[model samples]
Target: MAERKLNGGLKAALEYGPILAFFIGYLQLKDQVISIAGTDYSGFLVVTALFIPLMVLTTGLLWALTGSLSRMQLATVVLVVVFGGLSVWLQDERFFKMKPTMIYLLFAGVLGFGLMRGQSYLRSVMGETLPMRDEGWMILTKRIALFFLALAITNEVIWRSLSTDAWVNFKTFGLTAAMFAFFLSQGRLLQTYGIEKDKV
Candidate 1:
């Protein structure tokens, strides 16, 4: 049988599903651990230890079910295993927190380098689905790279300064809302560059 094509909604769900699952699982498990182990148990610490590997497993299952794993997904899995193992072995949450930072910095550096070379990596990723003029793609790439950088900084601040509950809330709802807003704001550009079915 031929593989089914995933629409934007499906793609978004698959991409965010594991993260959402982790958030939910962490909250539930944290409560359970605290309740079972008494007040002495560090719920946050316990959840942090369990979250990464759970997320990685969830993501892998999602990929297998969908039969799709993009380069970004592959990179994410690799990071999860490496950093997650370090987190468990070292008994520290710092490595897990740094994962997003590393991803953002890597993307920023690569995109910045691509821009310098007159290439738009973002365009390469989304070009087929959202065809646009060269200038439009370049603009989109720059904007996206900057957005990722902002998200990275935000994650760092939240993880460092906020309570675990707050960080979890931000990761689940705040970050998702921000991304949704960003996507909606790009509607005008997408419309401008959108190809009609007749044209396609």
Candidate 2:
């Protein structure tokens, strides 16, 4: 399939739209309970159920429309199926909640492994759109890897130590805000390295 290069806006929408749907799905079904579970069926399960199909459909739509999918997008769609399915099947929220941690760790691990092997994986994945020198790519990769690791750790803390509702709030709002801040913090670095003009 020919790769249809996505603009930053569409990429952001594709990445975050399903996430926002999760929150909306949760709220829409917050008070409803599934009786089959006999006890633990809750809003979390509803959202998880809604999430699986919604995400799968969204990913399929993206692929059908764009004729391309990124590595990260493909991985995330699979994770959503595995974890989200498990969450609904088991009538437990933990599986769903852990999805973000796993994703963050996976990215961190891949990037860290690349750095260990003396490769800037981010540059390989994003070089055309996010042009940078070797040094800039190295530095950006390190910071992004660390940031991803931090996000994983934070997800662990929030999900493990808080109520399901609180965790959802943190996942939808806190994480989103933090991600925006992280990108903002990299503005000078992006400027220094010079993102591709067409991309910017």
Q: Write the per-residue lDDT of candidate 2 for residues 74-155, one digit (tens) a residue.
A: 9988998999899887877789899999999999999999999999999878887777778889999999999999999999
Off by over 4 Å in 2: 5-13, 36-40, 195-200
Q: Model 1, 84-134: lDDT tens per residue?
A: 667656757677767777777777778888999999988777777787877
As for candidate 1, its clashing pairs are none
TM-score of candidate 2 against the unseen true structure: 0.89
Q: Pick the candidate with the highest TM-score.
A: 2
Our model 2 lands, by Cα RMSD against the true structure, at 2.7
Whole-model alpha-carbon lDDT for candidate 2: 0.86
Which candidate leads the pack in lDDT? 2
